[model samples]
Target chain A: MEKIYTRPSYIREGATSGFCPGCMHSTVHKLVGEVLDELGIVNKTVTVWGVGCCILGAGYTTHDSFGSPHGRACAVASAYKRTNPDEIVYTYQGDGDLASIGIAETIYAANRGENFTVIFINNSTYGMTGGQMAPTTLVGQKATTAPFGRDPKQHGYPVHVCELLATLKAPYYLERVTCLDAPNVLKAKKAIKKAFQNQIDGKGFSLVEIMSNCPTNWGMAPLETLEFMKENTLKEFPLGVYRDKDAE
Target chain B: MEKRFMKGAEAIAEAAVRAGCRFFAGYPITPQNEIPEYFARRMPEVGGVFLQGESEVASINMVNGAAFGGTRSMTSSSSCGISLKAEGVSQAATDHLPIVVCSVMRGGPGVGPITGSQQDYWQATKAHGNGGYKLLVFTPESVQEAVDMTYHAWDYAEKYRNPVMILIDGVIGVMMEPIELPDMVSDEFIAQNKAAKKAAYAPGPREDGRKEKHPINVSDGGPMGRNHADWMKYEGWKENETDVEFYQTDDAELIIAAYGISARIAKSAIGILRSEGYKVGLIRPKRVYPFPTKAFADLCPKKIKGILDVEMSMPPQLAEDVDAATKGAIPMEYCLTSYGVIMNRDDIVAKAKEMLNK
Candidate 1:
């Protein structure tokens, strides 16, 4: 008789997500939808989805969405925000899509101080293509491409996206949070909401990188994936606010 | 408007702005760099946006995003840069977004040269991307036609909800010519068009109780149904969008086929041949994709002795289209110069004379 839980209006009703079990992309999607709803920008929001795992993101939300080519989401979002400055624009991308092929686009958009938010989901390995070594793969992490454990000499070191972006003067905010546990997920939600708020205030280039988990790709159970992220991945990519001009 | 001298690259950029294009995203490349340079100065004055993208791949994707937001958007690059944009252009076509791409052609086969060349004819007409989708390829022969084609390209793009390309060569891109620009589009008109497009196609529910549809999103039905629907739109384009320019094809012993800068040279050659008592004609395709198949088919093989395809590529590219259109009934010859060399009028005239003698 009483309604305990109702689907968010921005989320597609009776639709199941295509993410793998224990994948953090679905959770991030829900957080984005919730933030859009709370800020009352659902109608005027346009989200660009990168080519990897987030290509189908438009189907999950009710807002206007565009699917960008591989590693080009930030560039697309930059133009979208500039053309329609009053509307809210954001991009959902993974480490492989952002740090590997799209590194130049990512850096330039931040350098130009384009007014948009980027929701970056960084798992150690490439989840969509069956656990290949990503740009953010840990030093000793085992992946399909790095079967002998990632050797820094051969594969290079992991990219610290937040710290790298912090060196630039323009970005209004840059934070790295995780969704491994309930407390961390709450912190991540807060960081996301603040990023969106910065855009509403006309601050330029806000990015919140979420350290996510890929249980299926990591060859671990859902709970074990959380432990692996905290014990190993967090050491390389520490969770903290790497840059926040507003705080200064 | 008074006729003013302007470069072809600058004219196209001015024409796009006059056509209510509110967004321009492009990268710097030889022969077409003036296009982005012009936009960088003009966009802010008109309350529009101009962004020099990091690469051509990013530029096309940026244009796609801007178009999705209900703004008339465009991007420009040279041949090598256009190759980088092919993937994004294909995605824009599949997503049914309206964006204009101006490719100022240069030498190809791996950044061969920066000078003018028509080697990109096949790349523009036959295979723009991996997808089987075809773009409305407009070949402009002069600075005036470049302005005219670009001014109207946005309308055609929005009408069909497809990508349109203005294919020109470096000769036309860098050459200065006197042209009258089109009437300026007012801010109110741009706002009205953007609002109308958003109402018709923007995702989610509109005030008119119409729901926005995503034809490319496979979650609706599947990619097969969506692809079939997109192909139907392409079929409609074939019926109404084909355009060509005919010059003295009525009583001709030989016909010359060309487009873009090559067509300009062919016209000059035709003048010489006409004075020399040769009954030679020319067929220039204005729209290369819905290619002038009907124009080629209408040529009477009985009266027409042979067709000479003039281009700036080693092995002729447009000749292949002519071969298909004529069904191998008419004999075809080639007059070409590869490695970014512009076709000379004298060379085309000599080639036409030789073909006629044979």
Candidate 2:
């Protein structure tokens, strides 16, 4: 009997994941674990988990991990990787953590070319804080804070982090992917692996922004959230490899 | 030990490196700017890292990260900047991460002034951030003391597995003085320090053959258990870690209580008062968080006529601690300056005389 599918070796056996039902955070966590296992760097990898839904990964993943205060994961990862350059370090951050409260740390860490991977989950809402209007929350999109809809006049605009970071000369790699479907999930995995591999190679500041869905926060069924991602989230966030210095 | 002439801020930076701090992240701020400036030039020479963070908030978080990575780490900032670092400092305290933070304080109720002031005594010794956590705060009174405190700071930090603070006023930060510097820890010692921490917690395989345990820092289980343990640790510090100096205090008529630069000024006043046949003395708390309550409790009520609280903080920050230590049994007088006003030795002497006459 050939075992074709199984849990990644990095994820602990019988560990209970704390993410909500139909949450892509678990999917993304699985991808990170798979990447760590494939690279054989699980033992040497240090994970910095940001506050919000991202912290749930600490339960499911078996790694030397620390939970940083909300939104400061990049700043934390910067020093972690710098001090232990021989080891691998990465941060799992949500849109609220990465784009809103932690934007300065995120931008500065990228600008400094800190050799680490940042796994950014853009779920278009503050999943952990009950769906507030995040910086990545789309205009005309409804959130708890924007009960009617996000108004450009009131909330300004949804920030495109990949585009914002592309302007920086220091970043070695930047890609925006999604876990909307099976095929896209595979692509997302590839991007995440490359981000981690870049750190292994001493490449500076690679980010893989995963455009995901929040079924619980978006107030939709699991299947309806996928449709939401395709119609609204994907249109605002647009999936692609935004910047690759190697390719350039 | 070798004698060296150095500025207070630079001495602190060099001392941390000598104590095996291999990673430093800091922002440019007044009075303490020499710290990061020294590290920027020195860290590279020692095979260490000096990162200028975008903000004070980021700098402290970076120190937190480097500490978690099993490296000796430090960060320095002034009063306003320390306010920004409160969040990261609180987080580091909660996790019991060993790191050093130097607050060379300037005046501030809000960016009040850049000159020397003892305004942050409350912030440093009391609530630096949230959760009502306490750091092992060291209030060094001179360049030599600052260097000595910074040198052994990491030992105390690692010993208790908690963040340690070196709180000096801006006067000590910029003042030049002759100091005896400690020998740098050897590279092997540094490596051993790191290896020990890595084995204990740095995100990977445990040295012993067992599953990776969740770092007590962020574990969700046993909130009551964790809080009780922290409460016990703080209580233990009160018993074992209080550091104070009794200068001419025995059988004195009037005793002055102060810390850091204010203590330096107050000591000179004590000297002046003693020469004039006034039985005045000084009580200096080397570690302010423990507040040296026992020092006050031990004073003979029959011999002590009054105690003067001298500080550069206008509203008398350290006085609260002093008052609690004496339980208002001893009548107290104040000679204070605020908003970056330097305390004068003459003013302290005058206040001591006025209190003794009354």
Candidate 3:
């Protein structure tokens, strides 16, 4: 099988991207856009992008996109998905947007089993502005505000949402994967594909948390940033399918 | 024509089924519980969805959910319940959901009275999901009107892609009236809307894994998307006015504006004034939101000093709308706040004289 792959026809004509030289968000956006395009849902898919670095998703993707209030992507996306159930809707949020401020909306939507896909980019530090503490930032990981590393006494422990959501019955697919390496990026794509497929099949809520790298924010070389996310982030958020209805 | 002598609430539920409403979600509130219960029994027969939500908020959001899966869906509640639903209502209106909501009007800011009152007339028409957006509010005076207005609400909801509210206070909700279900709406109309729902959102394979991707899609990205189109869709609704049911405007001074059961009482009050050799005009608004602002502006009275806006709210919601219509050209007074059943004819006549005399 000579499957020399060319990107889907819907892939935009441009260089890799304007993202930081080795940024993982661009790869993640590409994978998601590719799936949306290949599934023939590019015209129908609506993506609600939350504040922070990912806020530029409306311009990044060709899907019908909406920018939401901070941490309100899930709330707005929930309403958008419910009203236009026919439309393929997804929300792209950073960990701060999904876990900290949007805790109620994210948890309830997953618990209620609202049919939609949520792509959580766990970069461990807020990337749009100067790096700061994020819910997913490692306990001992240092950032601008947390220059001394996230202290358990002052900062809460990192939240493992994929593991947290697995306890609920609503999610059809839940996976925590990373884009720090070639093999891991492929795995993340599979998880995203499954999430979108679950929505298409109406199985239930689905989410794929991608351990993305912010080279510039991490103050590390592109290769080092990838290695740090793999060695550090993946250790806290293990890479695996936390849930699948058929597994049981 | 399913000619059943039905209560106002029951007629509304049946008309929903007739109008292709397959999904209904509601919280149990006084006077409108029949609507939720009726749909509960009837929805299963036709393979529809009926859910009793944990709270009014969840109930409204549930309908919002069902409305997306491409069903002509609805929810019914009273004043308190609708108050709980305002957040979801704003989301629905902004998101432009084609959903029908039946508010069997009751009294209150906080669980005032359950029997019947048009006190919520203003809130139903104007208040927000606390966000200052408005929805279409229809006030039906009789059980027959309740049924037809509810059916038409579903029609207009899909047409406008926003929530449509049918406001009926307790008297109309509980009263049994003979209604001719003239088979006026065909099964084809039902099928057409159902088809629209399906085409809008068609389901594919599931955990079963034997299906293609039934994509969830909505096309809009800033300027190139449907956001502009969605707003343009709302502008057309401005043209379809359903208020101002006028009774004898010719050579009439001292006209009064009222709605729902109050309008019925206002008519009798007008007759009372006429016997005393005074020409009184009655203007009833069937649709309270697209309130007949233009028509009411015409009847500010050549000789009379002002118009009496009648309602059942203490602070009076209609006074504001009346002011908008008259541009404050005429001083407005209120025949206000019937906490339970509508104001009696004599009470309204007395209020009218007090306002007109002043």
Q: Write the per-residue lDDT of candidate 2 for residues B181-222, one digit (tens) a residue.
A: 999999999999998876665564453432554553444448
> How well does candidate 3 match the true structure in TM-score terms?
0.74
lDDT of each residue in A45-118, candidate 1, tens digit only: 77778767776566666666767788898988888788778888888999999989999899999999999999
The DockQ figures for the candidates are: 0.54, 0.63, 0.10
Count: clashes, candidate 1: 0
lDDT of 1 by residue, B1-358 (tens): 7578999999999999999998999988998999999999999999989988888998998898788778999999988899999988998888777899999988888887999999888888788898788899999999999999999998999998889999999999999999999999888899999888766564523444324355356433588876787788778777888999999888889999999999999988999999999988989999888888889987778889899999899778898889999998999888899889889899888988898887
Better of 1 and 2 by DockQ: 2
Off by over 4 Å in 1: A1-7, B204-215, B218-221
Poorest 10 consecutive residues by lDDT, candidate 3 chain B: B208-217
Question: Among these predicted structures, which one has the highest lDDT?
Answer: 2
lDDT (C-alpha) at residue A66 in model 1: 61
| Cα-based lDDT at residue A104, candidate 1 | 87
Residue-level lDDT of model 3, residues B206-239, one tens digit each, is: 2332122212223456433555665565455556
* Index of the highest-DockQ prediction: 2
Native interface contact recovery, all models: 0.49, 0.64, 0.05
